[model samples]
Target: MTEKNYLTQKFEADRSRLRGVAYRMLGSLPEAEDAVQEAWLRLSRADTSGVDNLSAWLTTVTSRVCLDMLRSKKSRREDALLEGGPEPSVSGEDAIERETILADSVGLALLVVLQSLNPAERIAFVLHDLFDMPFEQIAPIVDRTPDAARQLASRARRRVRGGDVLDTAQTAQKSVVDAFLLASRTGDMAGLMAVLDPSVTVRVDAFAGGGQSRELQGADTVANFYNGLAQTARTALVDGAIGAVVAPLGKLYVVLDIRIENGKVVEITAVGDPDRLASAEVSVV
Candidate 1:
């Protein structure tokens, strides 16, 4: 440990907090890890001699990195509109059990609420309210004036405080999850197709699938994959959202997390490591 570079060691120390910020910004564990890794890469390649507040600098950089990713996602959706195909689902099933260990700790309510906000509002509110970051540093990352950033946070704050957005997102999430599970249990391929987007993606753990491709895309492909799925899996509250769990004899062995957009399932993450699944607190809503 002593032989490690001081910069590297310092980063390791802040890794937990940095990851928390990223996770809240992007609800998906895989995406949050990606953002944190991108931030570390940026720090290693840039000159930081002039940096005084290292923590603040890292926060700003990570926020910018997440902002760019979010904008890229929006751009892809627009391009997809013109191309006449929905955007490809970005799905990965790795380290989710670890990444989401803090999901509830970070306030699942806020995560659901933040999901409804535009990118800028999400960043502004997360940095200012959650992390106590001043709007001055946040403004540049969002490309808005400090006051404007504050106003964005204010608007987001109102919505969050009102709880209307949270209810809506949670309700929508639960409905989709229920529909998917019902279709799977009943082996209704067409029913499964109804709730899945054309570009739907299914990702399962490599260990679970015995070296299979681990990723299946397209509504038809994924729907077929689950047409006669397990009857054991039942609706459960996953990380404070309505998802599903597969277990036998009262021991959780599989967990599914879905990304629903416009009332359709676009991405699905399935984790089946017995240890990780058992570690998850599966509850009924």
Candidate 2:
């Protein structure tokens, strides 16, 4: 076979792995697929005589594409700023299962924290921490000095560590999610109130420039907001647990995996966005 045919075969063989890397970096399957495709096209058009490692070369190309998309998305989110309430629901169990399988490395909480990072930091962290790539190689992909890449990884690590509500706190959060779901689905306001902590705070992502996006302080307010939501939306079970999808709201769908503490709901997070939900699963339960 010709060099071109050999390269084509190699590309096909490596596409799936490359796409997984891209998805973890970007937190969007469609974007990841696009990035991999773009990388393949670039490979096809470039002179390959000097290319020593095809897999590494493709990974570099895909990483750069995903970084570009991340930057573009950040710009768009900043420009089109909307009143973020809750994430909209796309589908049910089958949809989530498909997304989880294709993503390969993403989890709900990780995806949320990823949104806070710049493209370079995100790429560096994913490469060094997730894929176990050496800093020597990651440096060039992110166009930074090896020391700088290390710092980027350090900063990303700090952010993740700080935002982690998992670890020892997961059981508490899971209990809250379970009780909240049971109460909401059954219209048991008393049961819901019984589980909520008096100091509970609900903050919706309003996409606002500064300040708490949508903050509801005190258990009463948080309870009331959820009670209202439960009354309006249709509830169903996904992956053997209760979930709800509400239309006409930005956070149209939310899934809760409760964390129980000394018997009260200390934290109740909204799991609606596919990426966020995926990441949350990693950090939480």
Write model 1 residue lDDT over 100-141, tens digit each, in one string: 456646554455556657899989988999999988888999
Choose the strongest candidate by lDDT. Answer: 1
Candidate 2 ranges with C-alpha deviation above 4 Å: 74-100, 103-105, 163-261, 266-285
Deviation in Å, model 2, residue 57 alpha carbon: 1.0
Worst 10 residues of 2 by lDDT: 78-87
Model 2 agreement with the true structure over 143-203: per-residue lDDT tens digits: 8999999999988876654533344454444455556766776767787789888887654
**Per-model CA lDDT versus the true structure:** 0.73, 0.62
Model 1: how far is 37 from its true place, Å? 0.9
Candidate 1 Cα misplacement greater than 4 A, ranges? 1-4, 74-94, 163-285
Could you list the CA RMSD of all candidates, in the order they appear? Answer: 15.1, 10.9
